[model samples]
Target: MPGRDPADRSRRRFARRQWARRWLAWRYLVAVVALVAVVGGGLWLVYFSSWLSVAGVEVEGVGLLSATQVRQAAAVPQGEPLARVDLDRVRARVEALAAVRSADVSRKWPDQVLVEVEERVAVAVVEIGGRLQGMDADGVVFRDYAQAPPELPRVETGATTGSEALREAALVVSALPADLRARVDHVEASTIDEISLQLHDGRTVEWGSAEDSELKARVVADLLAARKAQHYDVSVPGQPTTSG
Candidate 1:
C-alpha cells in the first residue's frame, strides 16, 4: 500500500468531519420538526377537547326569548368546551320553541358557545273559539288577546282554528297598504272561495278569495281614489266594478 501525503490526509480528515457535521445538523432539524408537530398537536387537542367544561356562553339576536330561555333552548352544559356542544341539535331545539322563527348555534373557540335567534312577527289577530288570539305570518297563534294591538287587522271567520282560512286572512292583512291596513277592522273567510274585509270606516270591501290581492287592492284603491265610496265590490277584478 502506498503511504498517503500528510496534506492529503489532513484534507480527507477535514472532509469526513464536515460530512459528520452536516449529518448531525440534518438529524437535529428532523428532531426539531417532530417535536414541534407533537407539541402543536397536543395543544390543539387540549384546546378543542370536548371533555372540557364550557366556560362561556353568548346569546344574541333574541327579542321575545329571554336569555334564560335561550340558554334552556340551547341546552349547552356550563363549563363544557364548545366542541362538546351539539350545534345542530341546539338550533333545532331553539327553533321549535314558540315565537322562535329561526336559530343558529356556533362555537366560540376553546370554551365559549354562541346562540342566535329570530322571533316571529305578529301580523294579525285571529278569532279562535270566540276568543281573539294573535297570529303570526306562519299561522302560529302565540298569544291570547287581552288587549288588541289596534294596529294589526282582525280576522273573523267560522272556519276552524288553525285552518287555511286563517292563513289566507293573514296574507290579505299583510298585503294591505299601511294606512289603509290599519283601518281594516276584520277579514271574514267563512268559505274558502270568499273573503271579505270590513273597514273601520264602516265600509265593506268584498275581496273574494285571497288570490290576486295586490290586483284587488290596486282596483279598490283606484275606486276609492276616483270617488268617496262607502262600499267596494272587487269580487271580479277587471270584469265588472261596482261601488256605493
Candidate 2:
C-alpha cells in the first residue's frame, strides 16, 4: 500500500480534471439551448401571435368616398398579425376604385392598419356613348356623372377617348382662367395641333397646338378681354388675327 500511494494520488488528480472539463462542456450546451429558446419564443410572440393581430383599421383622407368604402376596399386582413399584413396588396385594392387617384397603407402597430387615399378630381367632362365621363388633368376618364358639371369644360374628342387630340384638348381646357373657362361651351380637337374653343355665346377661338400653351393661354386671355370677335385666331398668339 505504501509503495503504490503516489500513483493512486496522481490518478485521482487526472480523473478530477477530466470530470471538470466534461461539466463545463455540458453547461455551455445547456446555456446555448436556453438562449435559442428565449429568442425564438420572443420572435414567435411578435410575428405569429394574436396579441399583435389587427383588431381594427383606420381610414384617412376620404372625401368623395365614405370611410366604410375605403375600409372595404382596403380589406386589411383582420385578426392577422399586424406585422404580417401585405401593405402593397392593400394599397392596390384601394386604388382599384374608380374614384381613388392614389393610396397609402401602413401598419399602426399593436392592433391597427391605416389606409390613406386621395380621390380623383374632375378637370373636364367628356361625353362618350351618350354618357358623361369625368376627365382629370392627366386625360384619365376616372368618373361618370348623370349630368355634366357646369363648372368644368366639356371636351369633344369625338368617340376616341385615348389619343393625342384628347391630351391636347385636356391641356387647353385645364389652362383656362376662371373668367374664360366659365364662357367655354365646348372644346373640339381633331388633332393635337388643331384645337378650337367654343364660347357660350357661339364664338370660336382657334387655340392651335399644345406648344407654348401657357404663353398662348395668357395671350388668349388678354385678347378675349380686349376684343369681342366672332372668330379669333390665337394659334399665333403674338400676332393674333380676329374677324366678326
Candidate 3:
C-alpha cells in the first residue's frame, strides 16, 4: 500500500491521455466555431448594415437640366445598401427625362451614388400652341421654351412636331451653310416632299425633298449669285429656276 499499484498507475495514465485528446478536439471545435462567427458577422456588416448604405447622391453633366431635377428624376433609393442599388433602373429613370439624351448611374462605394446625364442639343425650334419646342437633329421635340430661341432656326410644323415633315425641315436647316443658315428666317414643310426655306431677306427657296439637299444648297448659292429674285426653286438641282 506504500507504493502505487502497477494496474492503478496504468489506469491513471490512460485517463490522462483520454482527457488530453478530448481537450484537443474541443479546442479545434471552438476555433472552427469562432472562425464561422467572425465570417458571418463580417458578411452581415458588409451586405446588410448602414455602414455601407447610401448617404449622398451626386449628379453630373447637368446643364439644361437642373441637378435637382435630375436627382428627382433618378429617384435612387435613398439610404439603401450601396452594393444592392439597382443602377440600371436609376439610369433608365434618369433617361426618361425629356432633356436627357442618356444617363449613367453607378455606386461610388461606402455611401454615395452618382448619376451622369447627357442632354439633348437643340438645333431648331418649333412653335406649337403658343409654346416653343426645342428640336434636336433627330427631330425630337425635347423641351419647351418660353420664347423662341433667336439663335436657332424655326421649323413650321403646323399643329404637330416631329412628324416626317418636321424631319425634312430639320434636315434642311442642318444642311445649310453658316452664312445661308444665318439668313434663314424659318423653314416650312407641309409634307416630306414639300420642304421650303424662307430666308430672312424675304427671299424664298423651294427645296422639294429631303433628298439632294446638299447639292441644292450649293446650287442655290450659285443661283442667288446670278440673279436677285424673290423666289428660287432649286428643288431640282439639275434644272433650277428663279422668278419674282
Q: Lowest lDDT 10-mer window, candidate 2?
A: 157-166
Best by TM-score: 2
lDDT of each: 0.78, 0.86, 0.87
lDDT of 1 by residue, 79-186 (tens): 655565678888898888887888888887657778888888889987677788888876677767777788878878773434777777777777787867866888
Q: For candidate 3, lDDT tens digit of each residue in 121-165?
A: 988998876789998876778999888888899888654334778
Residue pairs that clash (backbone atoms under 3 angstroms), model 3: none
Better of 2 and 3 by lDDT: 3
Off by over 4 Å in 2: 1-38, 159-163
Ranking of candidates on lDDT, top first: 3, 2, 1
Q: Which residue runs does candidate 1 get wrong by more than 4 Å?
A: 1-36, 39-53, 160-162, 227-231
Best by lDDT: 3
**Residue lDDT tens for model 2, 1-244:** 5667898989999999999999999999999999999999988987899999999999999887899999898888789988889999999999999889899899897799999888888888988778899887767677789999888888887544356787778888777778888898999877888889999999998999777777777887777789988998889888888999
Instruction: Give the winner by lDDT: 1 or 3.
Output: 3
TM-score against truth, every candidate: 0.78, 0.79, 0.76
RMSD (Å) per prediction: 4.1, 4.0, 5.0
**Higher-TM-score candidate among 1 and 2?**
2
Q: What is the lDDT of residue 107 in candidate 2?
A: 87
